[model samples]
Target: MLSRPDVAVVGAGPVGLGIAWRCAARGLRVVVHDPAPGSGASHVAAGMLAPVAEAYFGEHELTGLLTASAARWPAFAAELTAATGADIGYRTEGTLMVGLTADDLAEARRLWAYQQGLGLPVTPLRPSALRDREPALAPRVRGGALAATDHQVDPRRLVPALRTAAERAGATLLPTAVRRLSDVDARVTVVAAGCGAAALTGLPVRPVKGQVLRLRAPGGVPPGFRHVIRGYADGEHVYLVPREDGEVVVGATVEERTDTDVSAGAVLRLLRAAVDLLPELAEYDLVETLAGLRPGTPDNAPILGPLPDRPGVLLATGHHRHGIVLTPVTADLIADLVVTGTPDPLLAPFTPARFLPPNPAGPVGVTGPVGVAELAESADSAGIAGSAATGGSAATAGSASVVRSAAGVAPAVPAVGGRTGPGPSAPEEEHTWN
Candidate 1:
């Protein structure tokens, strides 16, 4: 193993690479370890930087975090491209949520109301109006909502660009897997390993599987289908993200506790949903199918900041499906927490301790020997808690508390449908491409 650097980042996905990049940019000696860096979910993601479309039933706080990250993308992408000379394909074409049927229209209306309630910028469009904006959409489209702030990036290009940028910023990357936390002891260690974080000794992260399909436009299909399209069909959510090239990405199914395998049945369901939204997709060439696991927490919000008991350890995982969209802000928060000993106040709602109680049961993971009070005190002194809780904030002393009783010490398994699965096992080896 190499000597402990100023920072040791685990899991070289986008978030990990982002942290290493930011830290190295500040002249900190950083080392990133991952058996395969960009080959994880970052490789398989459709790369829609859409915080608004992915909003769920009651996640206003998470939405705030997402919007903040979306706002930061342009600068992040530009800086990385300037540093590495690689185009990450950042696009600001926005996104459209379409409804093909009456029920879908009603749901769209309800979602629009919810977004309005959250003070989001959304515009309701009738079927005719939607067609006017996107001429390629099927005329049968009933209605839609437009989120003009939504954007996207090309994940295939982004991950590699981040790796190159981080190296250019003077971060060392080790293309080897880290088996445990004891492998490094720095001022801080961040677990941004996506689904792999659960296998580390004391983390409370688990894998939630997602599958996606990629298609190439047939010859003569006019290129430039701007805006990511999310559709409501048969009571399920599906999306199609068009890239600068002819590739259109359609995805994904949220399956819990399954190994990564691209199912033909899943692909068919995706295709049907996409064609239903825009019939023209049927003319595209089916090019690829793939699957990857997202690191999901109990609340589906990321577990940010220092681990409850592990003073020197920090968590940047459990981003769930929004990992790609949230990477830049998450990385900035990680570096801020490590170098300055505090997180921005905006990140308060997502603290890992939010899932832990005032007094946790077992040994605190890799954070060392501090309790929550001490951790909060240190963070507060550093002014990390002053910023909007959008990036990092002090764990509230008593909100949505998760007290790990004797029963909470079991191995980490993904929280699915309000219940925990079988305990953790050896990290499963799986791969997919889209």
Candidate 2:
């Protein structure tokens, strides 16, 4: 008998379970360890499988990976469901990128042009076309476009299905948290521990908190809309994902903090925008309010491949907001590296070595999100992001040290460095919606 399992995976979230499943299916002995498996983005994210929408400027590499993974979602979802005999709530009605106000439409047009320049199929649609897809959308919606390949899945159902599939594939789950890398004894140790991985590997992974609210439709019926709605209402960027079971996941407030408290301000902002776009949502009953953290990296890209300066170790963490949508591709790529002992070309750009030599001075500088505030007539909003490299939130303050949360009030902090002070300002023209 073998002395130990071939693979000892740290983390039991969807990414960890997915890697375990793929490895076990290939006849590898895999044991996954975690204190709470599905306690991360699996429960918090809106689960938007939107590559075209995610394709941002200066992040083509990450965009390529996202697009590749999104392409595999259909087959991956089907296989997971078949293996577990459970529904993952995968939907492919596509996404409607709408704008409720003329300003929203104009700002989005610049992004649409940039996206189209990159050859993405972001087809503009008339107001009538948008309503035809989602009649419940407020009649005032000016116009929008269609990202026909942008889809969604319910992460609440997805995690359970991934766990069931991994277990059935001969992988073992140990309900134990790995506090140190030295304790694991396996031929290969893969750390897919999300934010926890940073503590274990000294990586730059950090926690990005997001607050989300779940609402259920009345009368036991599905939501009136068929397509996922990622749009701006009254200049606030928000996304509405409706499920087949009469549930709509309206969220979320992105913050640079670590706490998971669901603020009343977040709920009010999200619900206001949601109802403004979809009037029928006003009747939905608020069912649950929760918050979760996304694992973020320094460069805003997933860290794959072997750990630099460490042999027999691999990483599969720092997925950030794209974790749910990027699960299949990450799992497959990590498993392939473990099985063949070779990193794929696609993994070359995201290696841990990029931030190597261990900065002895201190943690890496602020290459991350700044608290963003927007000026609205009757409402205000705030947000943050996972990393510095993926285009941090727009800040008129022009300094990274001005990090703060948007809690529906303008900050009164005095100006610093003679630049625009840290507070709510006019929404800077940019492509921040993802």
How does each model score on lDDT? 0.72, 0.74
lDDT of 1 by residue, 150-254 (tens): 889988998899889889877888876776665555545777877777766345677788999988888735444777888887566798898767889898999
Once fitted onto the true fold, the runs of candidate 2 whose alpha carbons sit more than 4 angstroms away are: 358-434
Q: Taking the tens digit of each residue's C-alpha lDDT, what string does model 2 give over 1-434?
A: 64457678898888888888886765556898877788777878778899888777888889889888898899899889888999888999898888889999998887888888888879999998887778888998899999999999998888888888888978889888776776677666888988888777777989898898899999869989889988889988788899999999987776899898999989999999999899999999999999988888877899876664355667898898899888888888777555444445566577776666543443322221111111111012111111111111112223223322111111111111212323113232221100
Best by TM-score: 1
Number of the top lDDT candidate: 2
Q: Provide the lDDT at 335 for model 2.
A: 70
